[model samples]
Target: MTKQEFLRRYKDENLTIGAEYMMILDKISDAPLVLGCAYDQGVWKIYKTGERDGHYIIKEYASENEAFDFFYELVLSKHNRRNN
Candidate 1:
């Protein structure tokens, strides 16, 4: 889906525009790729890449929906597009 569409659909949920983030993953030749988001006291979160058993998660600094959207789009959408 387009970014605008995503924003519209999740607007009531308090989505934000132009979120910022950095991603870290295992760089070994055959290591599993994970998505990480730095939020809430600067903790590193690992997201499963579906090659293994794990959950798709959202890490946000604030309890509000906008904060969640910022982290989710910044970390999730970017990685997904690249991997695809």
Candidate 2:
């Protein structure tokens, strides 16, 4: 999806676009954002969103499962913040 669409869908949180990916910031305390991108290699790049050197990281993953796990971890972090 386009950055605008992503932002609109997750407007409650902060959103930013990078060179190759888009990220959705967390609404709850102490939770990192969710980062992802559509890739030319027929796979989606997903990671726990963070920045350095003014760029969002699409962390290198050995497999899709690892990337997806990070994504879920971010979600769990958010949920925990919401519940407690």
Candidate 3:
């Protein structure tokens, strides 16, 4: 999914994108998790920042669509777990 699509789908979830539009964050948790993308040399790198082991990248993706899909599923899982 594109960033705009993700935003539209989760408009009520209060998600935030970084100033450079390189990352999206979920701030509902105390330790906000993030899905970020960066251009490293000639490659587009998509990664997730997690607190599980001292705020590091827990996963990486080669494409924005894949990254966004995982991010979307992650948010849904977190919401479901919290609500249950």
Q: Best candidate per lDDT, number?
A: 3
Query: For each candidate, C-alpha RMSD in Å?
Result: 11.2, 9.6, 7.1
**Predicted candidate 3 versus true structure: per-residue lDDT over 8-83, tens digit per residue:** 7767775434332234343212233455544344433445555553234445667667756776776566556655
lDDT of each: 0.41, 0.43, 0.52
Candidate ranking (lDDT, best to worst): 3, 2, 1
Candidate 3: clashing residue pairs, number: 0
lDDT by residue for model 1 over 1-84, one digit each (tens)? 333443455555553322332233222111234444323344333343334544455443433344435545664466566556
TM per model?
A: 0.25, 0.37, 0.54
Clashes per candidate, residues 3 or more apart or on different chains: 0, 0, 0
- Which regions of candidate 3 are displaced past 4 Å? 12-54
Q: Any idea how many clashes model 2 has?
A: 0
* Residue range 2-82, candidate 2, lDDT tens digits: 334444544555422333434433221112433543332444454444444333445545455554555545544554565
lDDT of 3: 0.52
